[model samples]
Target chain A: MGRFVSIWFRYLRTDWFSLRQPELKKLPFVLRSPSRGRMIITAANSVAAQQGLHCEMAVADAKALVPELQVQDDIPDLTDKLLRRLAEWCIRFTPLVAIDPPDGLLFDATGCSHLWGGDDKYIEDITRKLQARGYDVRIAMADTVGIAWGVARFGNGSLIIESGITIDALVNLPPEALRLEADVTERLHKLGLHTIRQFIRMPRTSLRRRFGQHFLQRLDKALGSEIEILSPVHPVELYQERLPCFDPVATSTGIEMALKELLTKLCFRLQRGQKGLRKAIFKGYRIDGKVEKVEVGTNRPSHHVEHLLKLFQINLGTIEPSLGIELFVLEAPIIEEYLPQQEQMWNESGGLEDIRLSELLDRLAVRIGAHVIHRYLPDEHYWPERSVKLATSLQEKPSTQWPIKPRPVQLLPKPEPIEVTAPIPDYPPMLFRYKDKVHMISKADGPERIEQEWWLQQGQHRDYYRVEDEEGRRYWIFRLGHYHDKIYQWFLHGFFA
Target chain B: MLPEAGVIMILNRKADILTELQSDILRLQGFRTVNNGLLDADLGVIKQAFPNASFPLSCIHEFITSQQEHRAATNGFLSGLLSSLLGVDGVLLWIGTSRYLFPPSLPAFNLSPERIIFIDVSKQRDVHWVMEEALKCKALTAVVAEVKEISFIESRRFQLAAEQNKVTGFLLCHQTKKISATACASRWKVSPLPSETIDDLPGVGSPKWHVELMKVRNGKPQSWDIQWVDGKFVPIYKTVSLFTEQNQKAG
Candidate 1:
């Protein structure tokens, strides 16, 4: 019960070039490369092909045919790089995607098409998205990859072959559609066997003797008599639970029930394995062929079904079961070993090890981005800005103690320059003006002189002063560099209470 | 018996029963008198204005700050309280739009900055949401949120969560909008006062503030001058009655 999709990029290289340079898209362009001391056309765009120019043709001959044709050197090994990137992008359609190489992509579409609603809409979505990105692709879906590959390139009209009907759908195609060598195809034509339908009924041993074992293997693979395994770009996650509904589920309650069931089953398996999921994705396959998914991430590995469900429930509104969903899949792509701790006898709250605390953090991280929730630890740096670093995890402890000296409670993101009048060279300012307000210094303590870390960056040393104004408000101000010829540049760095 | 004497005795008996009923209602509303040596919040004379002559826990407290200096003073005072509440390994959540609390400075208030998880959100609604959610978790000792404003309903929700979970919440609200009523147990206004150095030293001494209790649910509203000297709040001007109250309870 496996289905496959083959996407043939007819003009992959030129389309990539066009996507990079829009001006070359309309012109008849060919990518030429030097091979065997001769410049050969490696790829030609559709416009160039229409003008009787094609790949493997000499650049000189192409130029002679169309003098106004545009020529550019082909990049070495660009095909493999381009195909791999395209294949990775195709993962959104299914978890399993493989590069067909040279100019094609293979997808294991089993149970995936229903997420997009149906087969027709599924293919339509893929083709439309690729076409929107300025790529020329021909796609075909069938029960076997061989038929999908054959129909995508050579067979014309309605590339999707019905299940159990691939033979009939591919019967009239030419023998070359089986991807045979030149000698075999030529020998077949010489024997007056131009179409596959003409000689498909012949005995297998005789056919093997005529065209060899590789040719029959390809034929049998196309006809579903043999299996072909696709090496996926990214391995599928082992912690995945799937539920197929006997009837379509359209209501929110139904979706919630489906999600809860999947979570229970998944959590039970995780509990037995002594592992927990850090991130999970809940996907529902709609009857209309569209896939709706919601993702939740936790601060720590969690097998708690209720807490995880609460996190997912916050985002369940975004999933629309348009016509009704018929299938659900839950995947835990990230998992970690989680050893359960013993229950507290007196229920004393532990600091970082508290499950309730981590659950709260996880909920907060989901609502507001995870990046916004941070814990800071002191770093061994003299610079004020670099003095603290964000802890990577909850269990991280500070390597160094907090500075003993008094610092401002509020530190500005960047220091604001202030106008100061100091009578002495290194003395604290007598008066300073910030934001059109003047403050008279009543008391001061300063010239801490924190130099910039030379190994980390290059900057002038700052002479910091903790000054108190007549109103009793204290400020941390610094003068940049030296007092250059009796002139000083002071900036207000922070406020202290 | 004479009619007037009998009426006075009946009135005295009725008054005693009424007081007992009132205390019972307060206890049912999540307000229990803090016995001596039961809590560690040594807020000096300021604690006398609470319902039971002790700093209230498991409730929402609102602080209104108009200027940056006032905000700093409030944070310093809050850090002092947080340090005591966060007994050994307890943690606090400080949520706001932008972080200005320098981590290195928290040590001066007896708080390890690492123990405080900072949550910086871009929206005010998110600040309240995080505060409410954090308040519901009993594991956290306290939650502090710096927000522009909060509605009555939102504050009520926070109060309910704190009451149910026994977690303290502090809302550092900016006084940019018109002040409205909220379901907080107490409201405070703290402003910086001139610091006095010991023995007339040259530099600024320990931080001092004018702490005003603007509103309290079932207690007196009063103001006091206090200074943070060596990680504890000490009243600048001592009153005889405050000491006698503590001594009487101790004896």
Candidate 2:
């Protein structure tokens, strides 16, 4: 048998606004957003609702009805952010919490409510907590998700439906309680089917032909014949370890101890499975209902408790323990398959495969950032800047071999314009002045012309030259276009060692 | 004749004892010759200036640069040395503030760019920290860092880390405000030298440098004209003889 609970936030957006701005609790205001070429009221607080204002009503019309009505712009995605946060908090009540978008949370309360004494105390505890957080909620428990949702939103009488009487409880509900489309509900009402009780005895073939198979599916789902899956807010992390404190942990030492414990357990589990974590988060749930977290990423999959703990230790200062934390959870969101390697007799293993190398890189990344560390592989492109591509992983191999053409040891980030004296078209520069210093060329290489990849972008071709000065300092200089062209420029691109 | 032979043998033994004492002093100064033989880079006559006639592997070597050309020469020379030091699969760490070394050009020095990891840290302190960390890892063949400034204490820390593992370190100090004393095995200044093409061929040839060993803990401080060709260092004999003639006339 399955028992589910649904909690509806009647005025989620407005309640959040009032919580942020306490003055909005008494004043009549509505959240307005432009829709269909008009400002429609998206949500209204209870004060405005009592003043004869409702959702979907035009703001101008509402203003005409109530002169003292206040209109505030509605924030996009506010409902989603609010509901997700609330659902994450609701995990304290039940492990399986699913977000019912716009304003609700669905929980598979199966085998869970008994822990709080019974279903009644569980509901009271949830209501008191949400209400304390300034959310007005109506919650209902039933044997299926559909019945729970219907009872939470539109049902009357007892909120909890017994295990065997799901159909009896769903019969009194209206057709819209089945979660049918608006147009379908409108058609049903036109056919005088005001409630599920009115259409209870209808033939299955006729109902399928008239109202469609979706309506039947909903009806059957509510009656416990069809199963409805609820995807939880967080996917169950089998690699996660949790530690609950008897006395709230307030000191940094306590937090470290908790982290070490969690890491030890997590690494043990990972070792047993021959898997390792590439990314993990250390979360501390405080008594004040706030979660402080520190995250770490590794260049390679690792389950070494000391190494992973050191990575977290670098950022532990960022976590604030206000009012103390009661629970600590460490979750590895990204894991990879790993095979344990036997220790080598000699320390000849010095490359990407070395565990110590990866550990060093991980420490460097945590301290300074992973983006600053780079390894490059040869690319097929002829453009000097695009000739090398950054390797995304430690083990990535180059697709092409390094170009054999002589390239400068140090390449300027951008080509610097220089003054040049050349011998007409298609000839190397005789002399060049860069950074206010003149370089008289002693010997010069060919004007190797590299045309722009016209398919990638539009630009002029470059004629490059490897020129040596009297001091033996070589430079890779280039002409932007043909020397005979009306508009031409020379640039010192790089310095050859 | 037997007496004369005995005297010559005594003198040779005295010279060998002096060399041994010199190596002992170098070891006390923290310059460790891990392999105690010639470095794989084939540094030509340049090896004569190092203690035990071999490059120190487990200590810091500092390179001083003032101009862009000099920096380029140092990078090229470092890469050539690294190509030999880093065996087939050895990894190197190149930590600097900015990434100006073209990745594809490392192959010219006989080192695959893929084998090198480049770390571009914005702060000088972070670069030092990363260099020290990289030097401590036995898995790395060498660490090459270009920092704006390094203190005597920071350089000492780098030496300590390098000695823990037999990882070599190359520190390139560019445009530093002042040349501070450091705990390095050798101090060098590599400047670009005019290239010589084979058989009067046109255009530039192999990269060459006037490599100056300005300071060595217990060895000779000298200069050499060296050229890189076919993945090996070739001493320029013509320049050496010309320098000798000029020195003789001046003397």
Candidate 3:
């Protein structure tokens, strides 16, 4: 049997949910959910564990142990999703990663141990990397998956069993380490066979007759007498390249140079296949085993090295390659067909500068955020707010004609209520008090009766009036509902410049 | 023989004129140096308030209100100046702590408030840095900062940046600031005058301001009761009534 590694995430359900929310980590907490009309504790954090509270215990008992224990509902599905994501991240270390149910991952290291120096060093590298990202993990390597899983969960810290000694390693451990059913372990303890060494000494026929065939099968798997197939989280075949440095690179320039060379090779393969990447991730594994990753996205599928380099440049300053990075891995997770781009840009004096404008926009969007830069296109709605819609791209054209009516420079998100005094309900206010200032109206424009769009389920008709104050300031105010109705209200909405 | 000799003398004088023209062109292009203080292009808008000459252009001007109540009128005057300077092409950047501008009210001062880009910064330090950067951009016509009184050094830096970039700046100092000297082209205080109704009509007239030019770098201090009508500023009769407690008390 080849060497296999088991990664154990202790209290996985508790760790995964509290991974992002660190405040809850310090408190004695338990994650419970309503099942069969009763809330039972599913998992507990390190704090609650010191209080001697265990899983499957009633919430009443856990609370009795620690009165102020905080409780949250468990999300088993989300924990499974997080586990799958961690499995994907494990690919950065080795490709043959499989999900060992509940809280562990099994990896068939095989001949890959030499890459990280040896089997022991490989375990240390992965442990440090996972711990740096704030995950509590224990790892064990052995000749078989069963023994590795047993040692990882029950062994001291991390252990690598000697080759062909899997049976001897399990002899000292309790019968529970065999992954036996609770009742079977209890029955063996009553029979004065608490240790696996005592149980293995018995004849196979006696053990099989006492327990079932499943118990013998588990025993055989752990002893390396049985073979188990491992299914990797990601397929073994993917377009990826890895470069291990002889001497670590500490500066940004060195990282950029390495990145450029790596992209040159990767893009060459992509170009040969006529494929372009929509998303590219550059990962730098520091000598201390910490991985710094920067991801960039393009609006369109692109394989242009210079253009992709420009996008990556925006993220270069953010990556902190502490100590020094010893390896670089670049992966293109999203790719599409590459098509020739046309050069005709409509911006005045459009040559290289127009292309630079898009690059600048990308950099600016990265800095100030995406929502700040918006392109507007006209919508067919008569209501002013719905008259223009935000366009996702500059190339989008307005489907409807822009309203010729003069629109205010800024529209209030919500209409503010104001006191009004007018001769008639249908007319503009002769005097209005807004924010404790009275503006006497001089010139008035309309009662632009705008009925709500019939397609909308519910709304009242509004009559808008654009009135100029004594100071020559103009305001767009509207009266809700019918003017003749006593329940109608007036609101000041927009400003006219 | 004498006529030919006179023609040669005239040709030599023409050659000297060509050399003088070449040096003048070089000076305009900045290839040759000009005196530092003499390069201020401020006389253009100075004539608006100061009758003797006028406030300097291409420089930062401080606008202060006499009382806390005069903020709206001072803002109106600033808006009017911005529109005059911007004319057609450039946009004005107004950096302030809070947004108190009502766009519909801007047309009274003949300003199109829509052309102004408002930058609301929360921190005190970001205000100065953003203002300085905004003033450095040549594409902008002017930058107006509504910061709680800036320091003299910061004002000098703003003035120097404005002169270099040729973008005008208005520093609207609030009432809370200590009255100190700054390196600005000029400073003015504006107070609102009660509107005058024409033919005893019901509403107030165009906005009028009691403008006081407190300090002028290279011009005489003056005052004007100015009114915003049509699209230009015109002198109006001074009124004693100010918009104060009487209206609020009446309500």
Candidate 4:
């Protein structure tokens, strides 16, 4: 079985210093500064020099021995954030990516290295590319994860421990290489344990009783006696596409252009997979300590780039760039495939009427607001008012005609009251007042009685009359209820020519 | 005021041409103008004198050969006079007639057909309602009604509706009534005049009109002969030389 390996580089800060000065790559110098005013010496490779300056000495005393010593405040958070961004950039190398603590990346290159011309070449290309981009990097390849980590940190001169040879390769390194704390190492040193070889050669039961089982287990793993697994920083299921700027982009327009490129790439991948995207999220990371993110949704599944751009256009106003964005990524949730609509020759002459109507409704809904425009349909009721239904314009059209009686051309929103004075049985009121006008009838017409729907209500009966005034003006007036009742009321219904 | 004066000047110029045309036509001897603006008197007299005069009924009448021939011979002769008569405020009554026939090829005079109300009542009792309604309305320019028969009481009612409505009643006397019997304001006979060939066109000129004055309420009954030209009535004259020339042409 192949051993799981994890490698981490120590003194990445010092490496960064040497990377800034290419001519000093092989020079042996230690970085020193006293701990006064929160300043501490960040690098000391040898114990003699560490004692000379003293780990917690004042800057004035440390500068006495080495007057040209270099000092830097520890900024672990900034370095960690930078390492994350660098790890994200390495995503193109392999999808199985993980972050190791303190400036380290763990890539499961088991099956991915051959695509980039083998594991050795892939590692060399990665380190050389990062170096060109002003990053200091140290890499190691080993069969076991703990051994690879120990080799990358302390073992020198291109150590490539072959599969199943982790124990022999890590035996010569110091006990600190087994990832033990300083206190543990000191206690082990007091017990005359100087190197990992001597510690591993000791009896296992005695080691366990003295240092606990956790320490022995960690040491055994470092020497390839056990196996290990790393949980990747990003899962394989997450779909992401990325764009790296050749130069640091500091403008909104530049970031937008890079975003479009990234979105195009992501959409193409989705289409090739026979999938559609329903939502897309864009993240713009700046060189400075700032991150901007935007998310947009679509009503329908689409792989069309223009439509995705339009959705992003609506959301672009909210993303704020504090410094300037240098990288862009677009991720999407993929949906299943749907069949395309087949076109008919007849329909080609003039497209489907439903589509045209839907387009018109969409425009109207946008202009007048969604709820203002409505369509009326027949309801399953006998009463006139209750027989009509109103729905918003976006809803589909109802397909049936009204079942009620044929209504007049004009209908008053509400009925108005009138006053009538006449004997009821023979003819309608000979004299009536409507809208503040009193008229006497000269010629009278028939009583076209339309009864109220009894199934809906059993209450009232109305008698309608067409009456001509002395001036030849005609009116359709109605009396609610029978004439025998004292509460019988008269109302003017409509006009006739 | 200045624009009104200018408009009056233009009107005076138009009236001069009309007066000149009238005098030239009156230089001859046979024509006359009766009851100057009383359209009912003119219609009654013309109907009494010539009952066969072409009158359009509906849009379809314009297709009839007899009406076309009659109108061709008359040259839209009565249209201008009738249009002028109908342009007033009154109820024009065409009583006792079921339908008022229309002539084929009757030149449209742009008259408002709504002004003429048709009341078809075979029963004599309904004539009271028609007359009452007509009398109640003063806005109607004419009321052409048909009835079975008319009496003195009916004639008085017709007069009342016409006066109250400020309208002219064209009472088409029934066939049973004697020619000199009905009490109307005036009566006459009208017919199409002889067709005259145009000097320059292949077709003949518009028809000429020959009207005979059979009776008048207050004036003497005299016949008027006229010709229609460009939608206007021009009196026909009978000079010694012109008459002899027309006679030779006829012979």
Candidate 5:
């Protein structure tokens, strides 16, 4: 008597070993074990035929029963590689991927898969593709990986397994399909429980006492009676690189030397990926469960190894590598691609100068912080302050001319307050004092009223005046609109030549 | 026969040629200082005198000390000069004192706010170094420097530097009570003039000056009593009554 060695690929490696065969639909098929001589009759159209085939018939006997049977020898390693490739392809769908055992893939395709149309269409496309490539495929999607696996293997057409129908859909399937061991199932069958429905109908306590709780617990998972989690194959794409040291390297200098090598490798990867890292994180995972992470930030996006090393050099003394770090991983979260403008070189006069300027800007950005250093850009607004914006240096230079207004040579950072005494109707103050100097305006021009941009709440409405003092020093001033019981306030905004 | 005829022709030509030469010399003199003492003078004199000469007029004036108060005084003095310079179109280049000049306060003399250009050198060794370079560019009308101690060698170099490029150079120096034995054509010492009286208030009054021409290359150096008013220098001509009366009253 040959012992049945039921090897379930667990839907994990099906992509690797299963031959593409769309023509095998509703056909009788058996995946036979070449080594152990056991067989899995994966499909049958009717319950009687399935039961008849399940009665421990020999492969030759089963082939005699169907006559038009399809058979395949189980190859595990090939199937595993195929599963891994499928998992890699699933990355294009969603980054979160996990390999489900016995031939299944669990993808957290949330908010995704819509790009390939709806979930049904996405699954249909994948199934059709796999079938065309000569493989037998069954697909099911559910809230839980366990339910999804059970439905794909057992539940046929339109196996939605609606929120409340998990148990119902899984009821008629065999107890063996619940991932129970053959010995356990045979022992349960001796107790007159064969199908999952009959076993599930039996008192939970009796079944637990007779065959242990593992069988029932697995059944509950299969029936969505309990929650199941699919372990993710890859976690979040953290900005980290790691290196394991062969020799337990001690000393800060040794760590620094090792870190330089790691940084070079990491930066090379980043450069190849066209990314400039603003922050570099070097984590030294020790043989002990201790982790030391040292982080440094650049003012601008930078992948220059020397500059990054110099920045890390400053903090080298701070990291106390206690028992020596065995692994080093460098990660950078703030990354931007290096976008150096391609020079036309048509005129060729300022090519060298432009290169020099680019180098200067890069150095400045590294020292000051990319965001902190900005260039003045002319804005379209008529207001003097709003007419210019602080722009990041990396953006393409704007090709706009400066405004034609007679603007002041220097604009104050913020409008200075002025002591003014004026009448209500004409907001322009008659006399104002600024910087502790009183100016009696002999000549005044302007009522250039600028309306507030209502969309921006902090905007102010003002009427400006170009006033000339007795000695002819000109000033630009404005009066704020009156509100509530408050009188209009006057401010010396800028100066005029 | 030719010698005698030539002698008669020469005699007849003498009187006619003499008058023409005299008139030509006179015309040149008037044009020589078309704006006399206007091109090179202190802030008070420049403000009172050449108000219309095109901007960026270089005023060769010196500050006696590097004290803050002295610096402020120098700035105030330059501010008045710049106000006058801005009235015309040209570039004002200040050599040594570039660091001290502020852009905003220079509107008084009408210096085009944008026209003022400043270049500073690390050492006194580079004074002539910049003059030749600056003068080579026709964009600038005036160049000013504070070289209080110019040896004969440096002064000659500077004069040569200015002459080659035909650009006016103002060399501000400390007052030498005794005239220097060098080749500078004119030197003027500017002291604060008596404040002008407007009603009971004293506005910036007539700029009084004791103008001494240390060396006049083509003429004699003499002391002239000059009063700068309405942007023009005029000879005061024995005006002692006003000061005497004010002094007697105070006494």
Candidate 6:
């Protein structure tokens, strides 16, 4: 019979961080979160718990018992990152490992246990491996995931159950083992249904009326009747290489050496598959499980080791090896099919300069964001805003010819309205006032009629004019609506140059 | 002030071959010009702005381009002038903060508004930085920057970058606040000239510009009444004074 295993790390917040600050483990300490004007204990160490201090103890109360107590604020995000990294390390035990966030791991131990002799030895191997790494772990294997989770957290630490005895094993465990909230467990205890067996034997309609369908669902899942599916955390990169350092690397040169070795191995593998990476991330995992990572993207797919190394060389300063790094991982998130090209005797189509420009673009992109450097492709539209679309890729060519007539080099993101004074109704304005400043028109070009886009509902039509002021400065102004209208308005739209 | 040896003085109707040859020779040595040189054969058909005008594309030309503080006419004249440099296959970089030039109006200048990329840099220092980097990029056809103030050192750096990369640069300085000396091969001041009606038409005439060469680096400085007509700029004769002269001659 197949079995499911749950390994719950009870005090994830205090344990994961205390591994870095080793001195905290020896003292009575509690990770606290500030509320209003005081602190509440979020997680406590063994010494503090032994001193009768528990989670949610006020700072003053905890301090009165143990005057030498240490307090640190809880960081949920940092703890979550540490848990995921630990799960990545757990991949050696089982192929399927799902993270139960805030602190636990569920593994599908279905049939691979014969290699370690039996389920007992297999569970022992995992416990010892993680305990040696200084994590307090509880392991329980059962026929179902829910029962495994309940037994690991509430029942015996290493309770390995036979398939048929799953129901008997969960009868004595608390209602909280079914993962019900504290409120629900309190109400369940009031009805004398304090264990999973008590709740399972209740009249279905009565249980549904009081605790709702959720309580019944949890009860069913805990038994072998209903199955639960665990979603395993999958690593982003399909192609990755990891190097385990015998001694932690502290110097930049040591990191460079490790990176060089990883890249050479990864590139050779990619070459065999005729694929080149477009995006690559280099991660340095510290001994404390905190990771510092730097990623670089390329203009085109590249398999050359030197090219990829050069891209990484400019950004190596961002990675800080605090307390030294023990594991180095290089991952390629995206790969494109790129075969090795033969060297041409003559330079073809000025390809060398193009490559050099692309390299410069990549370096600049890493310094600034990739979106800031933009290329343009012309869109076939008469409206100014829809006339151009941004080219996302470097190789995009303009699909249409450039407009033959004069267009402003710069475009006002939006049109600004102006005041106009013309001697006649339909002629270009003799003068216009914009921003409270009057510009006497010395040369008026046209009442260039531009009707509203009927297909798209915009405002009134504009009669555009290319008018030059006395300073030889030209403006593209327009009258919204017809001249005969009583509410005709003028807008200064663009600069000519 | 620059030597008059390079300036083509076409103030009269008659063709001056000596002046034309000198201007052509100066242009051949890669002198920056405000107007493309005119020929003697185009005397009646086209009034000449310069004796023989041709823009030198390989060299950096800085013009101290300014206008009256009250009116916004320099943009129109520049848009007309910049049209000559826009035919290149590469894109043009326009770095500025003021959103005055409408993209739809660019079609009037025979330029694809899409071919010009707009970058809005709020800081004056960053504007210069982007301009310098863009100039050093040889792949660009031209670089145009609109700055409220430009220092001599900054303009010198622009010239050096343009020269090293062999790309043309158009630096537009807003003159509403203050006018400082700019270091460039040429300096031009443009202001609006009244339009001339086409025959007896009731509507406005083609746009006319009173272009003045305030400072010339390697060419002579002059001013003319230049007008935009038929996709090109044609020099207009001072008709009011010329008509009076003809009447006095008849008496």
The sequence of per-residue lDDT tens digits that candidate 4 reaches over residues B1-251 is 99999999999999888766754654464332333344433443333222122121110001011222232222233344446665542223322223322211122432322223234444456544554444434443444443444666666666655554454554433333343344555443444554344564322233355554444432234566665565455557532222233433432
What class would a CAPRI assessor give candidate 5's docking?
incorrect
Docking verdict class for candidate 6: incorrect
List, residue by residue over A1-497, the lDDT tens digit for candidate 2: 89999999999999999999998899998999999999999999989998889999999999999898888999999999998899888999999999998689999999998999998988889999999999999999999999999999998997877777787898889988898999999999999889899997889999999989999999999888999999999843478899999999999999999999999999999988888899999999999999999999987778889999999999999989988999999999999987766224222566877888888889999988998989999988898888888999888988888999999999999999999998887778889999899999998997888888889988999888999999999999998876567699999999998
lDDT per residue for candidate 6 within A1-497, as digits (tens), equals 45888998876777766888998888988888887788899888777888999987898898988999999888858667877888888888788888886678988888867789998899999989988887888888888888888889899544787766777888889889998878899998898877777666769898889988888888888875666878887754578999999999989999999999999999998888888888999999998889989899988766678878877887988889978999999999999887556212111322222443455456556655465565566677665666667776655667886555445444567878888788667778888888878888777667677776778867788788877766555677888886677788878766654
Global lDDT scores for all candidate models: 0.87, 0.88, 0.72, 0.53, 0.55, 0.71
Q: Is candidate 4 or candidate 6 better by DockQ?
A: 6
Give me the TM-scores of chain B across the candidates.
0.82, 0.85, 0.72, 0.52, 0.56, 0.71
In model 4 chain A, the worst 10-residue window by lDDT is A342-351
DockQ of each: 0.52, 0.58, 0.03, 0.01, 0.03, 0.15
Candidate 4 regions off by >4 Å? A3-7, A14-38, A43-58, A69-76, A116-119, A156-158, A235-497, B1-251
DockQ score for model 2:
0.58
Q: Kindly report the interface RMSD of candidate 6, rounded to 1 decimal.
A: 4.9
Give the true-structure RMSD of model 5. 22.7
Give the chain A TM-score for each candidate: 0.53, 0.62, 0.52, 0.44, 0.45, 0.55
Off by over 4 Å in 1: A1-237, A342-348, A485-487, B1-30, B34-41, B238-251
lDDT over C-alpha atoms for residue A303 of model 4: 69
TM-score of each: 0.64, 0.67, 0.45, 0.32, 0.37, 0.52
lDDT of prediction 6: 0.71
Candidate 1: pairs in clash? A115-A289, A115-A290, A115-A291, A116-A289, A116-A290, A117-A288, A117-A289, A117-A290, A118-A289
Highest lDDT scorer: 2
Q: Candidate 5 residues A356-413, lDDT tens each?
A: 2233333333433334233344556666656655444433344454565334433455
- Could you tell which candidate, 1 or 5, scores higher by TM-score? 1
Residue A185, model 2: Cα distance from true site in angstroms: 41
